[model samples]
Target: MSNPQEPYQPVQPAAWPAEPAGQPGNPGQHGAPPLPGNPPHGAPGQYGAPGQYSSDGPFGLPGQEPPVRNRRKPWTILGVVVGVLLLAAVGVLILVNVVNGATNHARGLADGFTKLVIAGDSSKAYDDYLDPALHEQLTKEEFIAGIKTLKMDRTCKPAYNQVNASTENGTKAADVAGLITCDGDKKIDLAYRFEGTDELRMINIKLKPQA
Candidate 1:
């Protein structure tokens, strides 16, 4: 009669449980023997034989499922931050260029007016921003006489500040501010109307602390 404790044979590959240890011709005790050339479970370096690698090792052979890869979340975030800084730097450069252009233009206008006033040709300087109606009525000689007779000397230049431009109805104006130091510390605010390019028609003038 056959032995009563005979081991059950594996019907298919899935039917095999883990084999037990230390048996001759079967390297295992109570389960189906390991398939030919396959390593015994839990043996030293048994899972990866010579010229073979475990799934966990880098550069494993094809057809083997890849191990889960660790993501570098901090490095990804650092790259995004660097990109944003570059974009912000570029934006600041553009803004600075625009502001510089506007400042240079205003300075040129102020300088031109200063030169005209120094030469006792305040009328011509005044014409740059004058409206057509005002230009027709104001004579050039009248402007030259008034400032000259008032002893307005070219001792100090006008300190232009707070320059701005605005529009009202159909008229546009450039508000030029400066200290007109004719005798003492006095401020002169002039709103020069914009007639055309490089043409500022004086629409309003206010002299504070009359000296």
Candidate 2:
């Protein structure tokens, strides 16, 4: 038998199959597979750098735009409410001023009419201050005759107590009440009615014994 114990021969190991290109064991090769629809390493594709993922997509896929929000709805409603409140407040202030002005005007007119009567100028009062309808019912001579019997003191000033205004049949009207000090310190309660805003005219006057 061929020398049974011949010198030992070490068999050379078979070379590992050449590692495929881009595989883990191949140091000089890129091992990872190229991303689909993306450029190879070192060249820019749809993005700025190679092998770099885009933040605009999920897992390197195309991204969708975020949904829009209606950010102005709450602010719009708030603005509308604020505007309405402001307008309402302004309207209330204007109404208060108008009422006050009307009341003061009525008071002045009452004072003037009382002064004329105390001075025994009924003819002038009837012609200038009396309403047309009232003048028609009572003649100027009749008005002077009615006041002639009263003992009025021309020196004492007339004092107004209350003045109130209202809306009557779509017309602005007022009623003024006061006392007139006359001869011998006697007092008489006088009430006057006035109508119209721009051209206030005395509609009636009544004198009563003070209680």
Candidate 3:
């Protein structure tokens, strides 16, 4: 007699096909093109690799170099220094010219005053050029008498030479030396003081024989 239940069959597993050599699915193939920005195999050196330098500079990556500082700073400093020196020179020149002008004017006044005294024009000298303060203290007769005491020859002319000029406390003073042709060329030193700007006033005069 046969059994009524049917017999059970064993299930077989599915078999997958093996990938072809050098294909996209191959596992052992390593000669494929490198990915973007990746260095190829056996290349000279990789970017940012040890013991390698870029074309720009050592220790820096390609297309990067150390920063360059301002190159014009030194030139600019030199220019400024030169400009200041020029201005200082110009200022000195101008000061020299002003001092020289003042000295020349003072010399001229000294010569004129000496001529008046030698000419015995005491009244004109006192009225025109004498410092107001000095005129108040000295009478015209006394001035004339004092000039006469010099015993200068009235017929001979006098020559004046500028010695030096100086400034103190805003007052300009000049020293003038004179030689009288008569009386054996008597040499006299005169000190003249001036005050005011541009318009200088003869403040005082001091005369002495050269030792």
Candidate 4:
């Protein structure tokens, strides 16, 4: 007969709980979902983590646009202003030249008339300022007779002395005064009218001897 309380037989170990079908072992701790392309444990066709598009995705962060600047226009405007001023200056020069030329012409006419009258060539002097009525009415001899009546003293000799000239629009006139000495006896003042042109004409001669 064996002892019923004999030494306990060696006990067998209990079974471990079976790992769940889809859940991987170590991955359960992190609680992260698996990505597409990266390998799960090193098998070729197994699950892999998702990949990046060239290092990162298309939807990145925020940014801004560029700025605009001002442009230059002063040279163009300055050129126009200078051109107008030059034109005005040229116009003024032309006007002044015209006025000066007219004045010189008038003065020259007065001098010519004085010279003609003082020379005592009354025929030439009278003809220079021809009056139609006198030319028509008087014979050439009668014109000489009329001029002789003035009794100009031609002794000490007559000389044109001074002339004053003036003008209006295109019309010009001058007053010429002179000294005449008659045969060394007395001095006279002579006055005459001068009409303007290249051919100056004399009119209205007056002579008065000094007392």
The candidate scoring highest on lDDT is 2
TM-score of each: 0.54, 0.62, 0.62, 0.39
The C-alpha lDDT values of all candidates are 0.60, 0.80, 0.68, 0.59
**Candidate closer to the true structure by TM-score (higher is better), 1 or 4:** 1
lDDT for each residue of candidate 2 in 70-186, tens digit (9 for 90 to 100): 989999999999999999999999999989998898899988888888888878888888999898888988888877766676765688899998886778899999988866767
User: How many clashing residue pairs, candidate 1?
Assistant: 7
Deviation in Å, model 2, residue 170 alpha carbon: 4.3
Q: What value of lDDT does candidate 2 attain over all alpha carbons?
A: 0.80
Itemize residue pairs with steric clashes in candidate 4: 35-49, 36-48, 36-50, 37-48, 37-49, 38-48, 38-49, 155-183
lDDT of candidate 2 at residue 152, scale 0 to 100: 74
Backbone clashes in model 2, listed as residue pairs:
22-30, 22-31
- Answer with 1 or 3, whichever has the higher lDDT: 3
How high is the lDDT of residue 69 in model 4? 38
- With candidate 2 superimposed using the best TM-score fit, by how many Å does residue 16's alpha carbon deviate from the native? 2.6
How would you encode candidate 3's per-residue C-alpha lDDT over 159-186 as one tens digit per residue?
6654567777866666666555556656
Residue 180's lDDT in candidate 1: 58
Q: What's the lDDT for candidate 1?
A: 0.60
Better of 2 and 3 by lDDT: 2
Q: Arrange candidates by lDDT, descending.
A: 2, 3, 1, 4
Candidate 1 per-residue lDDT, tens place, 150-207, comes to 4556665567766766445754446566665655654444333233344445544443
